[model samples]
Target: MRVLLDHNIPHELRRLFPKDHDVYTAQFLGWEDYEDGELLNAAMDNNFAVLVTMDTSLPYQRNIDSFSLGVVVLDVHPATPDVLTSRMDRLVEACSRAASAREVVTLN
Candidate 1:
């Protein structure tokens, strides 16, 4: 899957995913200013199949059906890299199975 990760998510987490899959960040896309809705559109336009975000309000802020981009919301504590790194496997699995259309996949 082509995955676009939000800025809040650690960029280093990309190492945990499959090298065959394309992974990018909001910062890398020059979309740091884009809100959820705009970002979703950009993702679709870029052929990104899934989004990994730390924003809790995204699911409620935008209509899921509009963009056709699946989302994975991380719930790791912001205290340290170790905490977030521990959840990388689960995130990868979620991203692998994510649908083509809009959907919110939450991970705690």
Candidate 2:
């Protein structure tokens, strides 16, 4: 699976995904300035399978149904690397099973 980590997610968290999964960050993709909608569009256009983010408001702020990438929202404030790591198993499982556009998976 190809996972795109939103700008708010710590880049260090990329290391926690399964070894076979390809992970990239918005910052590394030169898309740190992209708004949520724009980032989702780019992820879809790039054929990213899942978009991992810490933005709790994303589901309410945008119509995810319009995008083709699955979204995984981490339910935690200040989603530091350690917090994300603790939730890595669920995140990885969500990524592995992600299919269909607009699929949403929440991990705490």
TM-score for all predictions?
0.90, 0.90
Best by TM-score: 2
lDDT of 1 by residue, 40-81 (tens): 999989899999988988888888767777988886677257
- Pick out the ten consecutive residues of candidate 1 with the lowest summed lDDT: 95-104
Pairs that collide in candidate 2 are: none
Error of 1 at 46 (Å): 0.5
| lDDT measured at residue 107 in model 1 versus the true structure, 0 to 100 | 83
- Predict model 2's lDDT versus the native: 0.85
Q: What is the C-alpha lDDT of each candidate?
A: 0.82, 0.85
Candidate 2, which ten residues in sequence have the lowest lDDT sum?
Answer: 94-103
Cα lDDT of model 2 by residue, 2-91, tens digit:
899998888888987778889999999999999988999999999999998888889899988888889988887556666777878888
Clash number for candidate 2: 0
